[model samples]
Target: MTWKRLVAIAIVIAVGFVGTILAGGLLPSGLASAQQEHREHGAPSSAPAAGAPTIAAVAVDFKFTPPEIRIKAGQTVNLVLTNRGAILHDLIIPGLKFHAAAEPGKKGTASLTAAKPGTYEFYCSVPGHREAGMKGRLIVTR
Candidate 1:
């Protein structure tokens, strides 16, 4: 083969390889790795125990359903986050330093223990998600 043809073929192969990696092919099960990374980053890894106080939140098209959550101080809460949109979503409580992510059409759970009686803000930490109205308020009672 000609040198120019060989170089062209090599370039095509390189591009395809890079594309595969960018598309998460290099990761061991994209979803699994993502969840593992979430846990490693201090995010809750499991759902609240059965019958525990659970708050279900649906994320769809840049909004969180039932945008306000109420809880009593010192209560443990299982935050059930479902991404109903065709994109990734997550619920993050900056005040409590907690976060969890869910892929499209999937669900994830995180546990939170309400601390002091106060109002805290929760939002999607994804870039531009919060600004797009992916936020809510958490009210804790004494």
Candidate 2:
């Protein structure tokens, strides 16, 4: 290749690398800010020191059985998710950054601590699942 073409390619690659590094740097700071915000406004009321409460649910064709769950604030919960359908399913609680997946005829469990008293939504992250009603409410009480 000609020197001019080589130089141009190198410049493009350098710029791309620099941009990637700069973008990566911003993410950690943004994550730290988000963690701080979660602590300030949405932190758990208390930590579970003993055995956690268990909640069980089954995933059947396009839906989650027992569409709602209730728990107390500061309680840690063991969520038992069973997929009894022909397809795969997973539970995702975005507010808590929790996810657990199970294939057909399988089971998955996730341990989560309840945050402040409020209603949070949990759903299957698989595309089109939520729209099809594979979702439910998680209510945390004081």
Candidate 3:
């Protein structure tokens, strides 16, 4: 594309994005409401599934409190991430496809079933957070 045409396209895209935000169309209605509720009340009050172990985890400004967690293979793990810092934090276990995000002073939850025994790294995907030491290790034991 020509330079001028590219610039015009960029401007149009930016304008559309801004308009969407201003019109409160950034997220769908159900998601927005759920997000609001999550921010206000943390995770749901429902009980954990049978035979699943609930592991409490906390995230701070630059690190996860435990820094590491240990669980068993062939077991389902329920991780609860609580953000006590002044910013958002999230837990992501790559291979497990498990992710839980918590806003400041709020909480989130996710479940992962580790089928093998090994070490898996968990980190916050937030920009610069992992580099700042916001990460931990999940040690799955057989």
Candidate 4:
């Protein structure tokens, strides 16, 4: 029946909208805020601050390319991650509280400004990935 099909479509739309709303509400404010600046610049850009250095990183089956990142204290770093793996992957710098994630075959970006010179551990936050060797270090120099 045409009416029955319309009702089903309406329900599906409503459920999808509610799910989107709930998912948005559940994310941390910082993550949600950064995600809001999405633009179609041929690709997503995190728009790092002036003079910031942009670094390209890759994520494979269970490892991160390069395995290390270096930056200068007081300088902002923009990182772009491309997921070349067959599963979801993410980048999380616990100390700096920076996170960037890309689903399989997708790309993601994040920016971090380290005001202190030190070594910070960065890794993929996805469950079990870190233990499988998805960890690295972010060295900040003065």
Candidate 5:
């Protein structure tokens, strides 16, 4: 094959490899990590409404103490999140715009105003924490 043809084939192969990596998301090209970062830190959206009341939540090693909570509507609530685990964890409820951070063997507390009555999801934003059942629920009532 001519030298020009060989060079063209090499360039095509290089482009194909780059495209494959981009499509497969095997590289951290910033764009590919956008969604992953959001997913990792986007825990609050899983919460219920924001107009309910105050409720307390606690976090522990791979678990959330008082995994279930109940509260009233229109009443300000306080969530006492205490991280008893050996790693960092965060309590996020985007729907309520509530976020709390806890460190290993340390206690953390966060508060949120509940504007509606419903059940909200609570989980640890730490890697693999939620998947390990490090989660709970915020139940609001009127």
Candidate 6:
């Protein structure tokens, strides 16, 4: 390539690298504080205690009471599922590989001991539930 073209390409690559770093550095302090809050709340990005259990929240209808769940490895998961819907519903955590069915005017729960850390998908396995857009993620750290 021509000397000028080569110099321009190099500058572009340099600028891109710097831009990424700057953007990352410029991320809001809220994000950092949020991470700190997680740490303070005992949410580590690694294996959970051997007997410690994770808490998962399930949604009802158009709302996810607590849209996200985070947990350490080797911990038991207590999936607290509430049905805010007027009809029966279900919440399935694919990563933890479990499901809980909820009936109207009642609460439901599914429990599991998570030995591994990874991302999980949750969906209403109840017939036609997922088709109504009842689904979310269950993340396990590591």
User: Which of the numbered candidates is closest to the native, going by highest TM-score?
Assistant: 1
In candidate 2, how many Å is residue 106 off? Answer: 0.8
lDDT of 5 by residue, 1-142 (tens): 9999999999999999999987778555554554465366544322334553444556776887788877777766556566676767788765677777767777565556778999999777665667789788878798
Q: Which is the winner by lDDT between candidate 4 and candidate 5?
A: 4
Instruction: Identify the runs in model 5 with alpha carbons over 4 angstroms from their true place.
Output: 1-56
lDDT of 2 by residue, 1-142 (tens): 9999999999999999999999999988866764553344332223323577778989988888889988899888888889998987887777877676778999877787767999999887665677789899988899
**Structure candidate 2, residue pairs in collision:** none
TM-score of 2: 0.63
Worst 10 residues of 1 by lDDT: 37-46
lDDT of 4 by residue, 1-142 (tens): 6999999999999999999999888776745444442211123234555666788889997899879988999888789899999987788776776778788999887778889999999877665677789889989999
Q: Which candidate number has the best lDDT?
A: 1
lDDT of 3 at 48: 47
The candidate with the higher TM-score, 5 or 6, is: 5
* Alpha carbon RMSD to native, model 2: 9.6
**Each prediction's TM-score versus the true structure:** 0.67, 0.63, 0.64, 0.65, 0.61, 0.55
Q: Give candidate 3 regions above 4 Å deviation.
A: 1-51
In candidate 1, clashing pairs total: 0
The lDDT of each candidate is 0.82, 0.78, 0.79, 0.79, 0.69, 0.62
lDDT of 1 by residue, 1-142 (tens): 9999999999999999899988876565755655654445455545566667888999998899989989999888788999998988888887887787888999998888877999999888665677789899999998
**What CA RMSD would you report for each candidate?**
7.6, 9.6, 9.2, 10.8, 8.2, 16.1
Candidate 5 TM-score, C-alpha based: 0.61
Error of 5 at 81 (Å): 1.2
Ordered list by TM-score, greatest first: 1, 4, 3, 2, 5, 6
Candidate number with the higher TM-score (4 or 5): 4
lDDT (tens digit, per residue) of candidate 3 on 1-142: 8999999999999999999897776457746665554354333333345767789999987999899999999887677888999988888777666678878999887777789999999887766677788889999998
